[model samples]
Target: MYAIVEMAGQQFKVAKDQKVYVHRLQTEEGKKVTFDNVLLLDDGKNITVGAPAIDGAAVEAKVVKHLRGDKVIVFKKKRRKGYKKKNGHRQSLTEIVIESIVAKGAKKAAPAKAEKPKAAPKAKAEAKPAVEKEAPAKKAPAKAKVKADDLKKIEGIGPKIAETLVAGGIATFADLAKAKPEKLSEIIADVRGNHVTDTWPEQAKLAAEGKWDELKKWQDELDGGKA
Candidate 1:
């Protein structure tokens, strides 16, 4: 039997005793890990597919080791601009050997349930005589609500980060411009990646001032919000 399972953000077709290398997992070496995201499974003569992932289907694997992949060279250059940059990177990876494929009845790790709070005691109602009151002669006009700006316009600010920033009350370009890089980092701490917000505030300032041309020029020279 073979199964297509998603592990560490990547999918692979695995079978019993098969070794596979995937993105780095938080699991320690020599420990066993269960991947419940089985996309497809085949048992000799029958094939089963999932809408997104099959429920109760899991692929068990044992971590072999943790290591880094081969080095990758990244080269960047601009014609007639005298701009050239070269970098190298190695991706962290983990090796694991598939142990078994469970078609059903796989037990998932459930979170601990929190105890519910007790209900408040009900208060007794008291009857009181109603009094007639005079209404105000005039009411003040409502203030206009400020529209949220598309923060994705700023380089390095993706949909997830933009949503997170909006949730943190930094919705408009003016608001982003006024925010500090350290605070922005704190707001997006849950987001994956080594995001650099050094140029975000300046980019937001330019956008807030309606300097699209300048902002675009600066963004073109930036690499994910870093100078």
Candidate 2:
């Protein structure tokens, strides 16, 4: 019977008494090692495949020896530039012999605990008297919706920063006009690159008051949305 198992980050198809060279393991020579990552097992008559690895299966082996592999040379060259480089490396390896493949073991997997059945969903609470709920509903959203300003029309505000301002509850021109420059910067703290908010509140004040010609004259004299 043979089993495919993973060891030291590599996989090998191994059988009892079979010796395999694999990446160096920390175990000393002559110490026993067990691999529980058995991906496939074929016991002469039956074949068992693991979803990823068999739960109770393992491959037992003995560490025979540790050694380094033959040196491999690596060379590099650049034409015309006359650059040349060379290197060599040897891999650490271990020799191990498979001693046994245990399909099931004394250390068997624990049976999974059964999940408790879900409690039936609670029934909805009975509705209150219509007059009681209706009174509160009328007063719930008392704050009227304010018309939002085109904040991008402000010199220092771009599309992304405009959305950020709106999300921060500064949706209208009047809101922007009253906002402090430092506070505006805090609102759009995540906007890309540094922004000079020095003149934004001033510009917003003009836009909120419907003085477009004056706002435009000031914007034309500004640079990169900065005062």
- Per-model CA lDDT versus the true structure: 0.82, 0.80
> What does candidate 2's lDDT look like per residue over 41-141, in tens digits?
89898788887788889999999998766755656799999887544445556899999999883233678999999765445234445557788767756
lDDT tens digits by residue: candidate 1, 155-207: 87889999999999999999999988767866776677546676889999999
TM values, all candidates: 0.51, 0.48
RMSD of 2: 20.4
Clashing pairs in 2: none
After TM-score superposition, what is the CA distance of residue 155 in candidate 2 from its true location, in Å?
54
- Give the clash count for each candidate: 0, 0
TM-score of 1: 0.51
Candidate 1 lDDT trough over 10 residues, lowest sum: 124-133
